[model samples]
Target: MPSVTIHTTQNVSIDCETARIGTRIGAWLIDAVVLLVAYLVVLYTAEQFGSGFNREVALRLGPIFWAVLYFFVSEWLGSGRTVGKRLLHLRVIRLDGEELTPADHLTRALFLLPDVLFTAGTLALLFITTGGRSQRLGDIVARTVVIQDDPAADLSLADVLTIRNREQHRARYPAVQRLAEADMLTVQECLLRYRRYRNAAHREAVQLAGARLAGLLGIDPEEAAADAEQFLETLLLDYIVLTR
Candidate 1:
């Protein structure tokens, strides 16, 4: 799974994954079309009373109404669907892992004015955001992120199983997590060519791991290093118990 990361003000990376970009953008585009049509209707209504097409009214009301409706109902009822997302399957979530509330809706809606005021000015910033997230002025101010509606978003038994199988030896040892992420060679190479290690560096790693494991287990590190079968037996035992 790809990890989601958000950069802090100081540029520290945080681990998190929001919704998918495809779902969010697809939903937004569908909603934009609907909003545009609705804006024309509102303008047509104003014009029927002899007030003319009311360009100013349409310009102001279009984005405002869409923002308000989307922030409030879409986020609250269906979690940022806005009819389009409900059809296409998407969601908008907060950046801080909180539910979107009424206040969040109103605040983010109000913050959108600067983003849609003109074509090439401040509103142009909507195009430059990273990760395909077009937050606009409001999204930046609200610190909210729109994520996808992935059905399988949690850890499953299979994930745990894979980790267990790949790390059986380390389960009783408590060093699997670190070893899993190491910049070392693959397990295949270590197994097949371990006896032929002529390089000092290769020999060093095997010796160090054995020594470390022995010291941790209160055994003779030299003895563990001398007999590879004992180490393999212990590792296999760990795997068997973990699976059972």
Candidate 2:
């Protein structure tokens, strides 16, 4: 699988696997089936009502309007996931590691006309295959790519909740309150990297980060140096306990 590395503002690097072409096509087909069913249901309901205006609107502007609205609203509210994407464990993410904005959602939605609807997915497949990041025309225009979601790759709030029974655990570091959520995320990423590779470079990174955090929190350097990994682990638990 092809992957892209995104660097957060805190300089934490995250590698995300791009969705396979077959997977993308499968997701698109699922979405298309859903939209087709929805469109037919609405058209049938409008016809049964026997309102000329409703019927006219359904005939003239139903499919396009509904599709655009569906894509926009689903991605916006679901955090860059449509029904198909959610089902397939796929998510759209920005290259710059920032949250998607309204403009990004709207741009992708509008560009779907040329990328999928008008071109019948031909152009989309071309771009996705050759773009080196599995981005279609809409994704390129919106500065986004579809990535396979890997739950274990990230430290989610759910994972934090499972860390040593939050209610019963006492925080060891009171100064953890001084760090922002992003800093904690960086710490978590550093820990994850070290755990994944278990190489000297990653171990060194964890040690350096632990020392830096200890200095920032006014802990003695010798204490952090004693067992930098344990020190960082305690800080992670402390941040979760104190903040949440």
Candidate 3:
């Protein structure tokens, strides 16, 4: 599939790069759960106190309470993170990557009225299915997009992790580090095009590419093949992110 990155018209800056839709959805679910908890807490607190608590205090104070909750708890403590976002490793921020102000928080929260009024989730569905950017009613109203907090995440890696690139790979794979760009290209290029090949094509190509890559890096072809591109890239990238 093709990917598009949203760029700012203001100063020639990229806003948000296209990331896997899954992580974005995952973050949204996390946020929804937090909102649910907040909703439940309000309801429960009212139950404990009185019918006055439920019907009067909560009904009257709910808006202000949640608004402030979003501002201070979600924004300040979580840095624009709701409960869902914290669990999913995601956060919301202004388009410019600045901390969202109280006004921004209030503005976004105000947009939730449509969802509440309908109670049918129409607004949310529209946002989830929206093209290019995952702009929900609130996000569009606020001019924001939902993205994976971990921009570097890739599906091929089972765990949340970070991988390095070519220059750094040399230091990590010092023996193969001496290999010229052409040699690296020879393997990577062939491997990169494996999808164009059929049947056992991916496997066969991987074996051959691994052999060549191994030769340059002075590693065993079998071992190199088993390592997979992800491991190699991880070794290249110095930083690793391990998530439970």
* Top TM-score prediction, candidate number: 2
- Indicate the TM-score of model 2: 0.67
- Model 1, stretches more than 4 Å misplaced? 1-16, 19-24, 44-71, 116-128, 131-137, 152-244
Give candidate 1's TM-score. Answer: 0.43
Q: Candidate 3 — which residues are off by over 4 angstroms? A: 1-15, 18-29, 36-73, 115-119, 151-244
1 or 2, greater by TM-score: 2
C-alpha root-mean-square deviation, each candidate: 13.1, 7.2, 8.5
Each model's TM-score, in the order given? 0.43, 0.67, 0.46
Question: Whole-model Cα lDDT per candidate?
Answer: 0.50, 0.80, 0.51
- Candidate 2 wrong stretches, greater than 4 Å: 54-57, 152-244
lDDT (C-alpha) at residue 234 in model 3? 36
- Candidate 3 accuracy as TM-score: 0.46
Model 3, 1-244: lDDT tens digits are 3233333222212223333457655755666666667777867876887554546666677754664465355654665666666566655655543445677766666665664334455776666566556555776667655554542433211121112233322334546545544454454344334423334766576566666666766776667667555534433222221100
* Deviation from native of the Cα of residue 197 in model 2, angstroms: 11
Can you give the lDDT of residue 41 in candidate 1? 76
Estimate the lDDT of model 3.
0.51
Sort by lDDT, top down from the best: 2, 3, 1
